[model samples]
Target: MTTDSTRRTPLVRLRSDGAVDEATLAYARTKIDAVLARPGLPAVTGEVRITRAAAHHAGHPWAATADVRVGRRQVVAVAEEATGTELVDRLQDRLRRQTDKAAHYWDDGRGTTAPPWRGGELRDGVSP
Candidate 1:
């Protein structure tokens, strides 16, 4: 549905705590886009965070976290790796697993949510 004339914002947003290279971001985008492109997904929006650890953690400087929403459900993925390649690769796997799990729990063939008449959470009446 996307064409050159019309540009749409990416479904997944990317952010970094420190200097993350353009190449790395672009690669991350591609991986995340793949993960978010499920057939039954509805209005998926996500934020991916790439954090650089302190000097002590030089062996694994890269940390990636993705917070993704599928309809009313939310899933998070996190990874720590030695390089950008590893970070993104692990991120993709983690994100895919989390999203798939959410889908399994929430998505039914009917695509309809539970009726509000069913049940609500029981609130604790005890006060502090």
Candidate 2:
């Protein structure tokens, strides 16, 4: 049976312009929820924040960062790509890698029991 923990994870989005329409937000939320719905994944806690980053240099395209808390650990994924096809392609590649890594880390019990933040020691700051 599916547990409630697996069903209550919330996905959140942060837009650069701070003017994201409902439709866009909904679409992003749906995509993220789909990803988190994978089997055997733990009940994720907190929301995944996706925000667009400013351009670093002239002619440089925009970038985005996805940060989320899985179990007791925080995972960050970043991607930068030019506008149009380049942007989409690059973001897809980077996001895929980031998600895969995060999934592996979370599922393999690497970050679940002994989080690296506390120097492998049990502490209040560390997540379960």
Candidate 3:
């Protein structure tokens, strides 16, 4: 995904596969924007594809997929839920976690002067 500095923050290109209502799409945009607007996040541009199963008896018909780039890191998250509300909720949570990890990629407790074998992290007087 390419970053567009001139565009709005959280530039989400959304696409739907079924009769998804405008309200639902708007709701998704709001949730996704909130996630992407967090502090420390890099310039992100991505797409979210929403699909609804047409089968009459499908339990979880709503599906959402997100492919986003956080700085130099790339994250792809997908989820399926029974309703639009649930779908967006899960999608935002996934996005939040993935972006958080990406934004803090350098602080993964690695490259430290002390390694785990050297009591870098001690608990109960024992190495964990």
Candidate 4:
């Protein structure tokens, strides 16, 4: 097991809409590390942006967006949850799936088609 100092740091940004506690940030970093540990993701550097809804909500109000670079490909996922911990967990789940697909597409020659909104360029380039 590698210590925090040994792992590549993830760039995390807490949106100005709301503040995120230190504990939550630490937890998110750990989750990112776990996601990067999977096979075929030898070198990953990415960013995680977490935002909390400004208004009070009855349901999930926190959102997390992750952009991870695995090899020559990138994997992105977004998730929302009622609590900070839940938000992190959901983001981790999404990252795992996205990373798997990216790895398969780049390493295993599998035709893994990403979601329409996964890549930022793809999303920006599309016109309705």
Candidate 5:
């Protein structure tokens, strides 16, 4: 992700196996932008991919993974629910926590930094 700070914030990339629609994508962007707008948070850029999991999950039928590039760092957040609820409600809560954690490494001292890409990997789904 590019981090000029002056450039336009990159659009969130919504990816699905033909399971999500334009409305859902729009809503996701709204909710995500709202979360990143919190005070003292870093300016974020990148894409969010939402995929429909095979019919075996619970809570939400959709699963989302965000690849955010803050300043020079990239941070990824992933969540899934077997049902359709507030995308931000089920996902942003956890994502917010992650942003908070990564904020500790910010260079601006005000938690204003970019998310790290780290080779395009999802931070939530990888096995340790």
Candidate 6:
């Protein structure tokens, strides 16, 4: 699989990718659910695609991509690892970073009527 970071929506449907196993898919779903449950986070939609490569790919045969949308922001992260758990962890980390940034940007107080100090204080220390 290609190692380059390609940032775009997946052409295939979310949860429709063929290669991911049931356990891994479940793990990804749980992770997505946790992110969505965050109180200050915006509305989101997301997908995960994990592909296992041939022997020619060497040490990193498992590649995973997570595409997520929070409000008007889109975050995409691609990673390759030797195991499914590691791949999921990396994807979750990347997605968290992206969403955190979006939350910070949108919560900057500029977009709302509240003063900047009030908005900054409201985030429960999630601001960037």
* Candidate topping lDDT: 3
List the lowest-lDDT window of 10 residues for candidate 4: 1-10
Report lDDT per candidate. 0.75, 0.48, 0.77, 0.70, 0.61, 0.64
**Which residues of candidate 4, in runs, are more than 4 Å off?**
1-17, 107-128
> What value does the lDDT take at residue 56 in candidate 3?
59
* Candidate 5 wrong stretches, greater than 4 Å: 1-11, 53-60, 109-128
Query: Please, what are the lDDT tens digits per residue for candidate 2 over residues 64-90?
Result: 455665555566666555442344345
- Which residue runs does candidate 2 get wrong by more than 4 Å? 1-8, 11-17, 50-63, 81-96, 107-128
Q: What's the true lDDT of residue 13 in model 5?
A: 47
Model 5 agreement with the true structure over 36-102: per-residue lDDT tens digits: 6567766666776666655663456777777776655678888877544555467777667777776
TM-score winner, 5 or 6: 6
- Once fitted onto the true fold, the runs of candidate 1 whose alpha carbons sit more than 4 angstroms away are 1-9, 54-57, 107-128
Q: Pick the candidate with the highest TM-score.
A: 3
Error of 6 at 118 (Å): 23
lDDT comparison, 2 vs 6, better candidate: 6
TM-score of each: 0.72, 0.48, 0.73, 0.67, 0.60, 0.65
Candidate 1: tens digits of C-alpha lDDT, residues 4-118:
1111336667777766777787787778777787687666787888877658648899998888797668999999998888999999999889888787777546665444444
Error of 4 at 35 (Å): 0.5
How are the candidates ranked when ordered by lDDT, highest leading? 3, 1, 4, 6, 5, 2
Worst 10 residues of 1 by lDDT: 1-10
What overall lDDT, based on C-alpha atoms, would model 2 receive against the true structure? 0.48
Query: Cα deviation of 28 in candidate 2 (Å)?
Result: 0.6
Please list the Cα RMSD from the true structure of every candidate, rounded to 1 decimal place. 9.7, 11.1, 7.6, 12.2, 14.1, 9.5
User: Cα lDDT for residue 54, model 2?
Assistant: 48
